[model samples]
Structure formats: structure tokens, C-alpha cells
Target: MRLVLLSLLLVLAGCQAPASNQASQPKVPTFYNHWELFAIDAVKVPRLKPAQRLDVDRNYMVSGMAGCNRVFGQGKFEAGVLTFENLSTTMKICPAELDRYEQSITEVLSNDPKVTMYRGDLVLRANHRVLQYRLVKETSSQ
Candidate 1:
């Protein structure tokens, strides 16, 4: 009787599910398909509101408004890094500050930057400068 009881207890213990390690691991956040620039290097661009945005399409093409001009480029995102290449922007005249802002954005994009998504915002860091963007939710148009 004693032996049978011991065997039954062992079998029950073996049948119990093991603790899962997956629950302890952190999950990576997914990048948004569209983002609008909210700030650059912790300072907001006052006049260029909603004029700078980033759209990552299905083809990995990056297109958006940089200040007053339309900018397009090939972009790749992998392993939390983003690289933009073959960038070309429309030649449009704008204010000196806007032109400077556009130039800064172009330079940063050209350099491969580390991408981070935090608190519902997209951040790109390169050469000690940070570009912050907010996720743009798409609405259905009838």
C-alpha cells in the first residue's frame, strides 16, 4: 500500500506542467506604419506643424514632407535599426529655418539610425540627435 501511494504521488508530480520561460522574456514592440514628426532634438518646430511626416509603405519606401518639400527614399528596417538610402527631395524654397530643419532631417536619415518605439512614440537616434514622432492612426474614408 505504501509503495503504491508513493508511485501515484510521483506520477502526479510528473504530470504537472513545468513553469514556462516564455512569460519571463520581454516582447519587442512593433513599429507603426505611419508617423508624424512631433519634435526634433527635444525642441518643437513651431511653424512646420504637421509638415514633416514619415510613411513606411509595404514596399519599404519612405516618403513624407520635409518642411515644405516632398521627400522620398528607400528605407530598410531590421533588428531595431533603420537605414534610408537613395533619398531625393523636391527643390522648393522655404524660410531659412525650415530649410535648415529639412537639411538636418535629411542628414540624419541618410545615416543609419537606431530605432526605438516607446510610450506610443517612434524615436530615431543618430549622431547624438533624436527625432521623435507620434504614431498616426489611419481612419477609414467612405
Candidate 2:
């Protein structure tokens, strides 16, 4: 009886899946979710851009002014927590127009792997960096 019960408990635990596993199965990004200078390239460099209207329902994404070179791979978040596999940025000589994105995304990704989004602002923290993001005024969730 004891052996049977132990086996059943193990089976039950194995059947249970964590939230992260469940969240990644679909892996679709919502509006203003995980907005980075990296993602759909919403930031127009020197000037920030809105993400509520940004569409990232594709394989590859390109945003920013023109030659931003700042981008990232597909990422998924479960219940508002970010998970990154690997992010690749350009090694090219970025002009002054695209410098903001390089700095911004680098600062963002270097900090923390976790973020919190409220209203139009996003708070991202990793190691020593804390980032505050303001979404487009019109798309405020508040």
C-alpha cells in the first residue's frame, strides 16, 4: 500500500505543470507587453514611441527610426514576468540617430530579467539597473 501511494503521488506531481510551461505554449504578445527598444523597435531613438498600436505578430520585427540595428528574439512572459533566451544587437557602427536605442535597450536588458507594467509605465530591474518606461499617453491603461 505504501509503495502504491508513493507512486501515485509522484504521478500526480508529474502531471502538474508550472505556470511558465503553460504560458509558453501559445506565446503570443499582447499590446504594450514586454516593450523594449529591442522588441518591435517602438522607440524612434532620440524620441520614444508608443507600443499599444505596435504590431509584433510576426517572426522578425523591425522598428525605431530607420537603421536602429537594435532588436531581440522572441520572448514570452507569464503573468507579467519576462523570460529571455538570448538577445542579439547589431555590432555595426550606429549613427547618432540610433544611439538612443542601443543605449536604451542595453540599459534595459542589462538590468533585470523581471519587469512590472502599470498604466503606461513599465518598471524593469535586473542587477543594478532600474528602468522606468512611459507608454504612449493615449494608450494609458489607467
Candidate 3:
């Protein structure tokens, strides 16, 4: 009887054991949300009157305002890298500085960027450029 109890206890313990494949488990993408560009290459992004944000959905679709133009595209995220395909942007003429910023942003997005989450910030690295974005929390006003 004692041996049976010991065997039963061992079975229960085995059942409760944490999964051994935890490390190999697929990483859940936490970058799916509204994000605002905070910095580029360690420098603060130029202030823009309009909304400067990027929205990434679970389907990997991306859309946002990059400084002066509105950008939309289908994105593919895999193995910690994000790449956009056929990215299209509005051709609205913008101020020289904002236009420059927009160009830089598009360039970064065009290149497959390595993505990492650091201290709650989404960091993208591509072509020696680091683009940092902060999550924009949505608030419900009743």
C-alpha cells in the first residue's frame, strides 16, 4: 500500500512539473499595438503637429503616419525581424524637415529590421539605424 501511495505521489508530481519545452516555445509578439515614434538613432524624433504613430495588427498589417505622409503596407514579422512589402504612402508635400524625417522612416521600414523589446520599448535596428517606439495606451472615456 505504501509503495502504491509513493507511486501515485510521483505521478502527480510528474504531472505538475513545468513544461520542459518552455524555452523552445514560440515567442508571443508583444509589438502588436499602437506605437509612437520616440527616437531615431538615439535622437528624439522631430516634433510633428499631426499624429506620429504606427499601428500593427495581429495580421501583420501596418499603417501609420510617418512625420508627413500616411504609410500603409502589409508586413511580415518572423524570427525577430520585421519587413514590409509594397509599402505605399501619401504624396502630400510636407515641410522640408518633416519630409526628410519621413524619408528616413520609410527607408528604415523598407529594410528588414531586427526587432527587440527592451524595457517596455520596441526597438528596431536596420542599416545601422535604431528606431525606438513606445506603446500608446488607449484610454476609454466614459
Number of the top candidate by TM-score? 3
Better of 1 and 2 by lDDT: 1
User: Model 2, which residues run further than 4 Å from truth?
Assistant: 1-67, 95-101, 110-112, 137-142
Better of 1 and 3 by TM-score: 3
**Model 1 worst lDDT window (10 residues):** 17-26
**How far does residue 50 in candidate 1 sit from its true spot (Å)?**
6.1
Q: Which stretches of candidate 3 lie over 4 Å from their true place?
A: 1-10, 13-18, 24-26, 138-142
Question: What RMSD does each model have against the real structure?
Answer: 5.1, 9.6, 3.2
Tell me the RMSD of model 3 versus the true structure.
3.2
61-136 per-residue lDDT for model 1 (tens digits): 8888887788888877777677865778899897887787787777777778788877888788888888888877
Candidate 3 lDDT over residue span 31-111, tens digit each: 878888889899997557775788887777989998779999998988999988688899899998787778778888889
Per-residue lDDT of candidate 2, residues 81-133 (tens digit) = 55546655656676664564456556555333465554545555555545455
RMSD of 2: 9.6
The per-model lDDT (C-alpha) reads 0.75, 0.47, 0.82
Clashing pairs in 3: none
Q: How many pairs of residues collide in each model?
A: 0, 3, 0
